[model samples]
Target chain A: MTGVAGVVLQVLLVAVGSPLLVGVMRQVRARLEGRAGAGLWQPWRDLRKLMRKQAITPAGTGWVFRAAPMVLAGTALVVAAVVPLVTTESPLDGVADLFAVTALLALGSVALALAGLDTGTAFGGMGASREVTVLALVEPTILVSVFALSIPAGSTNLGELVAAAEANWLSLLSPVTLLAAVALAIVSIAESGRIPVDNPATHLELTMIHEAMILEYAGPDLALIEWASAMRLTLLLGLLAGLFAPWGIATAGAGALGLLVAAIVVVVKVTVLGVALAAGEVFMAKLRLFRIPELLAGSFLMALLAVAASYFLV
Target chain B: MPDLTYTELLYLACGAFLLTGVMVLWRRDLRAVIRLFALQGLALAAVIGVLAAHQGDLELALVGIGVGALRAGLLPYLMARALAAGGEDRETRPLVNVSASLVVAAALAMLAYAISRPLTELAPSPATRAVPVALTVLLVGFFVLVTRRRALSQVVGFLLMDNAITATAFLTTSGVPLVVELGVSLDVLLAILVLYVLTNRIRASFGGTDLDELRELHD
Candidate 1:
């Protein structure tokens, strides 16, 4: 019963706290670029404002477009519940395997892509095509890198991997862990449609990948998609954080102190990650679409090397 | 002296070496290619350092220092000068395209692994487990040599192949004769100097370092 409580709390916190992460990133990026940006609470205000506006559905769009935002947000929320956020003692621990979680993410994005294609706009089709290309190249790297960590745990379950890592944090120093961490880091940046892969802040049709798909969306629907994007970015960052450094994440059981310790630790970790992401965005140019595959290929090689290193280096 | 950490580091170096080979094919800029070649040389020197520390061979340490200083440091410096002197920017054209060469390079790597399995099994030391990587590096180096059209890039490929073979020999045997190691090191150093001279000569005479220019001699 306590475990179920923890699970529900984990889902609520992740969904609610995720937008603050985006605001932090925006502010950090602005500050890094020598301008005072929006307040840390700005994303919350924007979401609230968006929710009150009228929902506009364009002609030629039917059920798919109408339901896409809800589906996207729901899928992301399900994944958030699946991660061992505050406590590994969640009732859903068994449901939180790596492949399944990654598959759910893919399904959600494919839903968005299908919605984009259904709209019959050239920009939407272009964005969907590019998203699929990025997805195909990135998914293998994600799987292989996660598998590198799971080699020792003997299970693809995310909670078990973190538990195994917490038991022996020294394993983090292994070349396999280090390499896979690097690969995951690159894949995260690419997956989230950030700089160097796609620029999220840009309005130009040529550079927009994620935004183009949502161009026709308005009001509450647009808000949900935007909120869902923030949540997705935060969840992936949390996954990377938990995988590489499971410290301060509750594994055995949590008393009040344990939960607090874990909460503080997670906040610090995600803050550092958001800042790193923003800092990286500061200097990187959006890579030409052709050049993006080379970057992803490099990550794939890193993941492959990680697997070989784990097998032979042991 | 710990086998586990040593094994991990060896595998790490091998991975890095293989990555450098892949990077050489992936990069089009001549300067980046030479830098990667130099990085490979640095990784090779690191392997030498590890092997020497494990075997406690003072002469091997000296060889590592020589190789590190020469191949990783001076050789890259010279190549950069050669590139600057020739005023060429990239390997703009190749017999095999970059993407095709990358695929072929991967196939060549697997072939190197398959071919070297018997030799890897013959070695007694745990370090010999990395021999497949050395052979792969060797073959990938040869791949780079045959496919690239630039004089400096070919020089890098030749040096890369030679370095891989030498690392494999030393890794399997544990230690080479000090005099032999020193002799090979000196020979490479001298050969690079000569190569530099030839690079400059080619540039001066032809205004470029593209080896395709020499094909006009069908006497």
Candidate 2:
């Protein structure tokens, strides 16, 4: 796998595998609750049906409302490109730094929030407000978490950071990594609008946070938004896997056998993570919207500890 | 390998100790404060034990054992008993809000680094690099004392302040002299005894143990 080919494969992996991961999680969640859930191909089927249908735009919404889902999906695709999935050397390696990645995610969130406000509904307004607040709080955690790795990596670039971790795999065993991983995991769940922050399977108007913004979208637009969010989840989990234990991510110029092994390793890691996350979600209830900040604060504290440990210890 | 790793562990434990002091400033629950205080003490003892091991000093290892037993264990146990008997399980108000105190703690940490830079340069040891964390803990401990309302929490803050000093002395030089360690640990036990007695008196006199109630005595 050359650099360009590896980057293309990584992008395709996220775009194609994103829906399946969502489906697997749903099935796992359903099984944990003692029922046969939708099959693993359900998200693809949902996307197909959605694409065939006509998208309806609301009467009183502007271009931002119409454009939000595209921007959201587009930003997610860019992030997928930048994040190393099954390769150590990305062509976009320079731009795939931590701060750049976070800023892109923030851009998507802001676009969605603006769209939420543009809809002129109380639910959209409230959800947008909540999303921005949560986003601001979680940003520091992500920064500190990433900074903890950067301390040893000597650079914030995701590629170099992964390389640094891979070079000294023992650092991954440090208490700093433990704290950062926990912080990053919690931040990932909240950022992706997963369980405990906002339930993906839910659309109860009163309890929904992410869905409130998408309430006005009808057919294809809704499909795009759904796919985009799922892709973001896939990319984040992939990033986490790459950072913590990227033992098998194919490097540039690796043989086909290496790429095959990388693919299998990535699938196993992501599947295990998806199932673990779904299983964990089954036991925990969605926290109150107010309480979510407290959780994020705790995550920030953990990340702060990681940063402090790296500073003083390492 | 063990010496280098243990020295690093000592530095990380110093961070934990500082974090616990900041936590006492952040949390309002009395039990949470006591738990964090105990964690700080544990971290303190771990730092001592790790450094003692790295240096291979038997006397310092003995002091580490004593610190773990008294500072981390016996003292917090006694404090928990006092808390239960006093029945003031929450610190309802503070002189400053949590967010403000967090900012102050950060600023004080910066100040600690600035003030300790000369000392750190003088020693030029890996352990001396953590002098600021020890100083930050000392400052934040007093911040906790000033902000928190509960007498038991204030006592924990006082203990935290003392622990930070111990950490500073240990990190900057060899572990504090053995006889001094014994004397200070005893001083802590006696201080806790007096604070416990005073807390009970505050509770019995004013029907609560909040330090704000003590202000009523000035009138």
Candidate 3:
């Protein structure tokens, strides 16, 4: 019963905390731009409105058109379940390894790409092609960076990685961790369709990689995609915060009080990261589509440096 | 007792090699061939996982999962997308037919088994079992690369060759060090990305993924 309760609590935290993180980012961006933003609960309100609205689908769409959002949301939920967002110990921790987490993310992207191509629109197909092209590069960076960390940890489990990071003598100063953190941050932004790699706010089809793919979706479907998108952004950020900046996360065997403290730490860290991401978006313009490859290649090079640094430094 | 005997695993690895060779002969579609390649990866991963889990080594478990995820899951997924995007379906014309290909693959496997037999006899039980299987898979993968006209199949064959090497490493000893295993997997992942990018360019340039067209290249 206690194990089940822990699982339930961790899941609820991820589900509830993700949108709040998104809302905080929006609020921070608005404040940065010298305008009062919507309340932190604004994402909830928007999601509710979207849920109640009628769905409108374009003609000539197939089953994949309807299935994409569900798959994306499902994938995000699975990732949240597997990743230790608030605590190092969770019931579902051992069932999934880091490789599984990576697979879940890749599954989500593939579903989105299929959905984009199913529309038979030029922009959708183009976006789908470009997204996979970026993915083919970005996925390796994610794998390599995490592998560098996993090597020192001696395990591929996320929980183990975090514990090792906390217990290690040079967790923060290790060149491998440093390079991986930077590589992961860049990959996170690219994977989540954020600034420099992709612009989330722009409706201009020519420049939009993520938005262009989902132009045909509206109402409930769009809401789910948007929610899943927010959840994914938060999930990736939380993963980064937990693995790289795992200062306050509840260690295994810590009691309820420890968990509560960890939750607070997590919320604060993710909120701060959300703001930093927003600031980055506010400061930088999106890279050209062709230029996106260079950014991914640079991240891959950084990840390679991380592994080499681990070997040389340690 | 261990869950599986070392000799049984050796014979099983050899059987898996033969089965994958047969799979290569059976597949006609470019995408289907990639799927077979992934299945071959799964078989190798399973054997490695068994060996690692039996020996109670966490490093091998981690390596097993990483290889399974990359070779069986991500690589196959990427290749499938490339094939779909390339749209070269129903147009597969191999450089060699199935019967002739199977005969050649069988001959190659026998040749590899004969070549590795003496060296393997000097090794330990598990290592000896894995050696021939590794060599056969390697030879067949290269054969597939040479015989397949589709660029996608060639890429799958390339990855299969890597899988054979990794399997050999695991069977030859307890396992490679964790650092080497992670590095090799990362290397394979990067190689797959480059392959995907090249496939796209190949599609755009030739309007088909057939290597026959690419052979027209001359400088």
Candidate 4:
């Protein structure tokens, strides 16, 4: 019963809070750049407007284009429920394995990438190709870095991994933790289309990676993609906080009050991470497209080192 | 500060040591390479400090500080001076590209792990277990030396290999005699001074310090 309640709470929190997170990040970036920024409710307002507008489909697009937003939003919601953000006692514990969660996230990305290709626009194809290229390099690091954590935990389940971290807090000081943290941080930035990889603020087609794919999206479809993207970013940051700094998260047998407190703590953690990321973005310019691989490759090396250190240093 | 045991801290330092070596290969800027080499030196000092603290050896601790000063401070300072004189900042051409160099580095690290298995199996202490990291740094430094075209980068490579040797000595046996370590440190300093002068002479004569240009003299 508690597990079920926790899952419901997580889904609701992500659904409502993710847009606010996006708004807060944008507001932070704006403030740092010395501008009068939109309030934190701006994303919610934009979503409201987009939701009321009529949907439009570009010519020659088929089912892939129409269904992509649903797939992406659906996957993000599922990942939100499964990952141990607010509580470790998720109802979907069996599906909360590291590989399952990663694949679910990749499924959303693939759905969006295919939709981009289906639009038959040059920018869409270019964006799809680039996203897939980054994704191919990114997935391994994500898998291997978390695999480093899972090694000592003795399970690949996300809940179990977090539980292990909580159990032996000293493990956080291990070289494995440090290496994996750096690796996962890099991949998270890449996955979320943040600056130094892709500029989320950029609408210029030449430099666009995430934005290029969705230029043709309109009305509620665009809103869904935008909301799903925010949720995805929220989830990645939340996962990083939960896995590495699993201090406040509610564990198995935690009561409803514990679950509520955990929710607040995770919200705070993810918000802090989001603000830091945005502030970091203010100081960074996007890497040239060619140099981006070098960055990802470096992260991959860190992840590999994390895995090796976890094994050999033990 | 979580309560990391001595062995865990030692492992962390060694990890940083090896990571700096790989980063040296990843970066194309000569100044960044020098910076990473300095960082590697600091990591070496960390390895020695951790071991010294674990063993309660004052001599080793003092040696760690001296090595840190020489390798991290004095050596990189001298190298940066050469870099400033040369006026070229990037290692634009190398025998191997960045991606390939990184791949080779990974392979060398794995090889180090494989070959160090017996050595670790023999003693099987935490310090002995971490010898492979030093070995990896040694091989990577050598890789940098052989593959890099610039004299300054080669000097970094030489210093990295030297740092790794120092790390190995500290990790396995705790410390060598203080006099022996100091003698080696002074020798390395003098060697770098010589190389620094050579780099400047080469740059003046050839208008650049690309070692490949030295081959033109054969014709």
Candidate 5:
């Protein structure tokens, strides 16, 4: 019963709260840049406005374009339900394997990229290609770094990994943990279309990787993509916090009160991470497209080192 | 602040040391390279300090402080001074590009782990376990020396190798004698002073400190 409630709570929290996470990040960046920005509810307001408008499909586009947003949002929702965000007793624990979660995320990305290519616009195809390039480099780092983390826990199941971390907090200070944290942090930045990888705020034709793909998206479709993206950012940040700092997360035997407290704690953790990421973005410029591969490679190296350290240093 | 054991803390320091070494290869700016070298030095000192605390050896603690001061403080300051005088702040083009250098660094790290297995097997303790990281730093430093074109970068590479040697000595044997460690630090200081002068001379003669320009004198 608690497992069921945890999934529903996680899904609701991610669905309702991720937009505010995006809003908080924007506000933080705005304040840092000395702009009196929109309030924390702006993303929610934008979503509301986007939903009321008529959805548009471009001429000659097929089901891929029509279906991509739903696919993206659906995958994110499933990930939210399964990722052990508020509690380790996720009902979908069997599907919460690290590889399964990563592939689920990748499936969303591939859906969007195909949609981008289906649009047949030059920018759409270009953005699709670029996104795939980044995804290719990022997936390995994510897998390997988490693989390093899993070495200590002896399980690839997300729930078990967090449970192990909660049991032995000392492992968080190990070199392998630290290295994987740094590597995963870098890849998360890249995977989420953040600055120094892809500039989320930019819509300039040449510099945009993510924005170009969504250029043809409008109305409800655009809102789904935006909401899904915010959810993904929240999910990744929440997962990092859960994996590295599992404090306040509920264990298997927890009751209803424990689940509620865990939900609040996860919101706090993800919010803090989001704000920090936003503040960090204020100081960084987007890397050149060619240079981004180098950054990703550097992260991959760290992930590789993390795995090596986990084995040899054990 | 966490209740980390001595071995875990040492591993963290060694990881920081190895990371800084690889970052030196990734960064193009000479100043950033020097900063990373200083960070590596600090990490090396940390490795010593952890060992000192683990063993409760006052002498090792003192050596750690001296190493931190000399390597992290004075050496980087001197290198930065040379950098300001030389005016070429970037390694515009190395023999290898940044991505390739990073991949090579990963390969070297793997190689270090493979080769250090026998050492670790000979005596399976935490300290011996971390030897491969120091060895990785050593190989990466040598790779930097061989591949980088700028004389200042080469100096950073040499210091990286020196730092790795110091780290290995401390990790494998707890530490060397205080007097020998001090003498080694002084020798490094002297070497830096000589290199400092030589770098300035190269800048004066060639209007830049790029070593490739010196090939004209080979004839």
Candidate 6:
């Protein structure tokens, strides 16, 4: 029961912490651009403001449009619950595997895309179509890269994988983990609607994919989707950290004090990653839709090489 | 909830194979077929999940849930939107008829059983009851890929085949190493994405995504 209670606490921390990671990243981006940004609580403030504003649905939109934002945010919460951030063991951990996490992310994207098209706007349809096209390449790379790591860990349970990484010799030299980490990093940039895939800052209608879909969203509805998107970005990066750098995750048998320290470490690591992403985005340009596939394919090849290297080296 | 028995899981796998096979034959509506495919994915996930839980292998349980989420939830959602956006919402009439597909499906199942006999013999797990069912699904998926005229159908078939392979891995080994399972599913999803892109192009130039029309590479 204590173990179960610990898992619950870990999930709550991730849920609240996910938004903070976003806040910190935004602060970092602002700093890099030579402008003082909003305080770290800006996201929460934005969400409150959006909630107070009225939602103006596009006339052609139906139930899917109304429900899409909720589902997107809902799925993100579920994914957050399942993924290990501060601890190896989570309550909802066994409800899915790592592949499931990818699927959940993909599922959120699909819902968002469907909502984008349900409005019957050309931009909406175009954005949805392009989103799937880019994702097609990115999704596999994420999976294969993770596979490279799982082989060395010898388990699919995210918790077990973390534990294995802590316990194994192969964990050190597994080129697959490195390849997967790199591949996941690329996919995260793409998946999160960051630079070199789609620009989060741009409203250039022709180039926009993620922004185009949400162009019609305003107020609280838009706020949830945006927050969820940020959380998704943080979550994927946190997953990369958890799986690849499990040094600080509270082991299943660790006490409450150990988990507290682990949670702090997770915050520090995710904050660093968030800052790095902001820096990377500041320096990069969004790739054309056609060119994005090449980027993801490169990640896939790297992951494949990692897996191959693992087989020979480990 | 008493632990789910191996026999129940076997039934679920067999049912999944049947539903997916029938979906290939009965549906021409792309969106409808995608929904059916999602259901088939759920069935596949259920079988794996139950088996994993029964064995108390947390890793397998995770894989089962993950497979369910991806195959059942995400892929189908993507296909549905893609079909809708392309305005390719019609039922795809294949080169072959429904009756022929059923016959082929049965034959494929038999072939799978025959081919899997040696492998099944060597499998140490008691969950081998679904071994033949898994193989048959794979074979049927291949048949759908080859015999179907529509690109979407072929892709769905290809995915079903991948699910069959995943199922086989589960039944034979009780589950794969988590990372390997992750890699395989990722590969399968990636393959589906590639197929989706190709289908989009095929639809754009050819006005439809019929496999018969994709003969530009053919002499």
Clashes of each: 0, 0, 0, 0, 0, 8
Please provide, for model 5 over A1-314, each residue's C-alpha lDDT reduced to its tens digit, 9 standing for 90 to 100: 89999999999999999999999999999999999999999999999899999999999899999999999999999999999899899878899999999998999999999999999999999999999999998999999999999998999999999999999998898889999999999999999999999999885887789888999999999999999999999999999999999999898889999999999999999999999999999999888898998898899999989998998888
Classified by CAPRI criteria, candidate 6 counts as: incorrect
Give the root-mean-square deviation of each candidate in angstroms. 2.5, 2.8, 15.7, 1.8, 2.0, 16.6
DockQ-better candidate, 2 vs 3 = 2
Worst ten in a row by lDDT for model 2 chain A: A305-314
Misplaced by over 4 Å in model 2 are A33-36, A173-179, A201-204, A283-288, A301-314, B1-3, B86-88, B93-104
Off by over 4 Å in 3: A1-3, B1-219
Off by over 4 Å in 1: B93-112, B211-214, B217-219
Off-target runs (Cα >4 Å) in candidate 4 are B1-4, B177-180, B217-219
lDDT ranking from best to worst?
5, 4, 2, 1, 3, 6
lDDT of 6 by residue, B1-219 (tens): 352344444454545544454455555677777888888888888778777767777877877788889989999988887787678676456666554565455456557667876875675344564576677678878877887877778888888788888777777776677688668778888888888888888888898876677677855
Report the C-alpha displacement of residue A313, candidate 3, in angstroms.
Answer: 3.2
Candidates in order, interface RMSD in Å: 3.1, 3.6, 19.0, 1.1, 0.8, 17.8
Q: What is candidate 1's lDDT per residue for B1-219, written digit by digit as tens?
A: 887677666766766776786678778898999889888888888888888887888887787878778878888899898888788878888888764665566566567667866876676466777776777678878988998989998998888888788778767885567688768878888988898999888888877889998777797
Best by DockQ: 5
TM-score of each: 0.92, 0.90, 0.59, 0.97, 0.96, 0.58
TM-score, chain A only, candidate 5, equals: 0.99
lDDT of each: 0.82, 0.83, 0.76, 0.90, 0.92, 0.74
The collision pairs in model 4 are none
What's the C-alpha lDDT at position A233 in model 2? 91
Interface RMSD of 6: 17.8
lDDT of 2 by residue, B36-72 (tens): 8889888988888878878888888888778888877
Chain B TM-score for candidate 6 = 0.89
In model 5 chain A, the worst 10-residue window by lDDT is A201-210
